[model samples]
Target: GGIITQTPKFLIGQEGQKLTLKCQQNFNHDTMYWYRQDSGKGLRLIYYSITENDLQKGDLSEGYDASREKKSSFSLTVTSAQKNEMAVFLCASSMAKQDTQYFGPGTRLLVL
Candidate 1:
């Protein structure tokens, strides 16, 4: 019930190309989410799933994001395209709503 702001959102990949960011957690948490962070700002939620197949969109959920086929993993896809695919993709899981969240390492993409 609060406003989320993203200062200059990032694009992930070229137009019409699949860019997938995968996440896996071992704690078997019930809730998982994807977020992006900027050096000067705070974490911004992109998308999240409460359980296996339940998805909810965040402010930046313009692309495809999902809970994985297995409960231990989750995926955030800037799917079949974006003008530019760059953002710090952080995956976090919690045992219950707003409980302590354990975060996976942020993902960085490189293209030459």
Candidate 2:
């Protein structure tokens, strides 16, 4: 078994600030994903990478950027933070898109 680690745990930002969140996994999975969760809502996929240096934009990728520096790491950036907003950003890994995904502890963000 392996675990996924999300850095900083908490993030505070000002309106319009660009914030970055990071994730790393020891599972050595071939695919990694970034998802955003709003209160009372399901996760929305932001970005995913199938392998090192391979990037794919998801439904909610318009205001975000992602990078897969290596198979074990993925990172996401909020292009512009919105005021008085809060959300949890989750990281996940899977052997294939159809396979079950293992999630990391989320990074919570609050914008003031």
lDDT of 2 by residue, 1-112 (tens): 9999998799999999999999999998999999999978899999999999999999999989999999999999999999998999999999887988999999999999
| Residue 30, model 1: Cα distance from true site in angstroms | 0.7
TM-score of 1: 0.75
Candidate 1 local lDDT, 1-112, one digit each (tens): 1111221233335567767777777787888888877666689898888888788898877766565566666777766554544457678888889798877767764322
Give the clash count for each candidate.
5, 0
Candidate 2 at residue 27, lDDT?
Answer: 91
Please state the error at residue 104 of candidate 1 in Å: 0.6
Best-matching candidate per TM-score: 2
At residue 105, candidate 1 shows an lDDT of: 61
Q: Residue 47 of candidate 1: its Cα lDDT?
A: 89
Runs of candidate 2 exceeding 4 Å displacement:
none
Worst 10 residues of 2 by lDDT: 36-45
